[model samples]
Target: MTEQNVDLGKNPRANRIPWPPLLLIASIAAGALATWVWPLPWPGINDGPAHGVGLGFGVAGIALIVWAIITLRKRGTTFLPDGTATSLVTSGPFARFRNPIYLGDALIVLSIAEITHSIWFVAAALLFGILVTALQIVPEERHLESQFGDAYLDYKSRTRRWI
Candidate 1:
């Protein structure tokens, strides 16, 4: 079998273990722990306004995930870790943001930070977000560029990294 075929058969590291998803899970766990252990000073109104905002961000993040899934399904594509794209997706949320899911995740993290009113937590979230984007998304884009050529270039030119 060819190397590509071998790659397809073997469970690649990226496919088997996705760091971004894992990081996000870890961040959420840490945030929840901080909420219980560190217990930030709650706002005057305990009607859970902060919680509501955090929930809103969570909802947005979920929506973005759905958007990404829909786009991938519609295009019959997969953004595999091995830098493979069966098709290009330029519709739906992809039309607006090149990395909507990442942005949504960042927003969710930021909201959690706000809800907890922990500067340290906020900083941690921001740093984690930046690291994930740089390490994960940037490389994915490079792969996409290599795969799609000028079409990908034009798409990159038109779409913002985050919106």
Candidate 2:
């Protein structure tokens, strides 16, 4: 709304809302909560191939999350987007996409929809994606830009935000 309400700090979560946990909550709410709150007319997929594909996506999403966390550990930086940054991470899954963990979350949410065959879950997942991108990722990116300056700009120029 007003410039006074805006925060352009390198660590923008000064308001105390952590990004990673918020994203985790969003994904869970999107998938799990929606699954229960709005049960599908036809729950569960019977086809073997479809189940395999859904399982594969879910597993891949988990793998990406694991890899991203490992990379963050290797970089000596916390995974929380709003946390203090020890280093500019640009390796492993990060080389491919800036927000691998968030991408993983999206995949997980999507996988839930696929596995459950729930259009409502899909809607929730989509809402999760949109909300995270707007409320979290944008601010985190601004924080990074403030923190890392040209280096972050260069990386932003090079890497896709999501892949």
Candidate 3:
């Protein structure tokens, strides 16, 4: 695939503080609040199954997130997208996908929506993914491409953005 062509030298929004984690938190809060505002029931599934599904997805998502953090920590790299990258992580979860954390974020969003059984929550989840990808992931990728050059290009070529 062709790389995204963005002018880093003249970009005006590069100095802004990153808010990906805050966005994730807001998404979760919005979901929970939405459940309170318009709590709905699953069409055919029982409460037990719903809870089980939510718990399953939530735990797995949490685990994935933790794993990604641990990986970054073990490698002594910055998890913050806005910061400088210290290493080109390509092991563990990184070996599988370029963005395990983002995948985990999506999963967590899914789990929250599932648990709440709220259409509004699901909408928030979708918005969460879209916003993160556009605001955080895109910038991070651009930085990685610039910082790591051909190495990142090779990694990006081999790995999927979100698997």
Candidate 4:
């Protein structure tokens, strides 16, 4: 039997942000701000119908987070800012989208905004996600391409960046 090995170079820009730690901090900050500044309205204090809509958004956001986590775990992947992969995963949720984590994060943010009925926050989150993806995600893709080459390229071609 013969084994073929492929070399994927080390990513120069990997682990840029210490993402897990940063994510924790950001989550705390966001939660604090939301609590201090724009706390959820007390039930019966606002329009009844709109409450249902808001709750739906909140639920959707939670659902997306759960789905994203499951996908990552099943694929043996992480959402770290750095683009490092133990293996090329082209199955499960990844088969449908190139960046399920990003999509899920965006959905959660948008859902929170909608739930809060904060147009300003919704727009801000959308812009933030776009910028983060551009600055962080795109470069990571470049690194993946450098490493995985044609396989990554084929995956890129087949999967949508955000869907």
Which one is best on lDDT? 3
> In angstroms, how far off is 60's CA in candidate 3?
1.1
Winner on lDDT between 1 and 2 is 2
Candidate 2 residue spans exceeding 4 A from truth:
1-15, 30-46
Evaluate model 2: give its TM-score.
0.81
Order by lDDT, highest first: 3, 2, 1, 4
TM-score of each: 0.73, 0.81, 0.81, 0.68
User: What are the lDDT figures for the candidates, one per model?
Assistant: 0.66, 0.73, 0.74, 0.59
Estimate, for each residue in 41-127, the C-alpha lDDT of model 4 and write its tens digit: 433325767667666655765665567566566666554666465455666556777666655555566555555555544544566
Deviation in Å, model 3, residue 142 alpha carbon: 0.6
Ordered list by TM-score, greatest first? 3, 2, 1, 4
Error of 3 at 64 (Å): 0.7
Tell me the tens digit of each residue's lDDT in model 1 across 37-96: 777664534457766877788788788877887777666666443445655577888888
Candidate 2 per-residue lDDT over residues 1-163, each given as its tens digit:
0011123344644224665567667666666766677676745567989878878878988999999999888877778765655567888998999889888887877777777787666676677778778877888777777667777788889999888
Q: Per-residue lDDT for 33 in model 1?
A: 79
The ten-residue window of minimal lDDT in model 3 covers 6-15
Give the lowest summed-lDDT range of ten residues in model 1. 1-10
Model 1, runs deviating above 4 Å:
1-17, 33-51, 79-83, 114-121
Clashes in model 4: which pairs? Answer: none
In the range 4-104, model 3's lDDT, one tens digit per residue, is: 33443433232156667788888888877877877767453558877888879788878888898888878877677556565678887888888888778
